[model samples]
Target: TQLLEQSPQFLSIQEGENLTVYCNSSSVFSSLQWYRQEPGEGPVLLVTVVTGGEVKKLKRLTFQFGDARKDSSLHITAAQPGDTGLYLCAGPTNTGNQFYFGTGTSLTVIP
Candidate 1:
């Protein structure tokens, strides 16, 4: 079965610290979606990189797709308290009806 796994389930750092999150899987996916969610609200789409070797950046965040489409990485620069949230990676299969979400990464940026 295809599954997405994330490392460093929890992270706490200073306001200006930088961090990187990882998403890995053994199965290939048609598309991979990245989301940042706050408590009590649904996850909001951050970036979706479907093609292998694709890289996209938003403001202070950078996302990269693995050449094999089986892994991804998210790097955040100059972290702030407002940037604290749950980061999730989802991989959609051919059916497109379901998605495999990563274990989830909880980040806390202390002021």
Candidate 2:
């Protein structure tokens, strides 16, 4: 079974702070995606990494895929109140009919 687990189930930070969240799994994935979601809205894709050791940066956010393809990371710099939301990491399951979402990391950035 392929499963992804995220750490620090919740985080609260003041504006301008920085933080990192982790996603790990025992199974390898062909590709992994990071998404940020706001209340009552579907998750928006932040990035996708298909190669080991791949790194992609979007503004103040950075994402990395593990060399083994079994882990990933998300780093936020100079966080703002707008960054408050749920961050999720997901990958297509072996069956290909489902996407496995991580435990989820909820971040709150206070102004």
Best by lDDT: 2
Q: Any residue pairs clashing in model 2, and if so which?
A: none
The TM-score values for the models, in the order shown, are 0.95, 0.94
Each model's Cα RMSD: 1.3, 1.5
User: In candidate 1, what are the lDDT values of residues 1-111, reduced to their tens digit?
Assistant: 438999779999999889999999999987799999999999999999989989999999999999999999999999999999999999986899988899989999999
Instruction: Give, for candidate 1, the lowest lDDT window spanning 10 residues.
Output: 1-10
* TM value for model 2: 0.94
lDDT of 2 at 110: 95
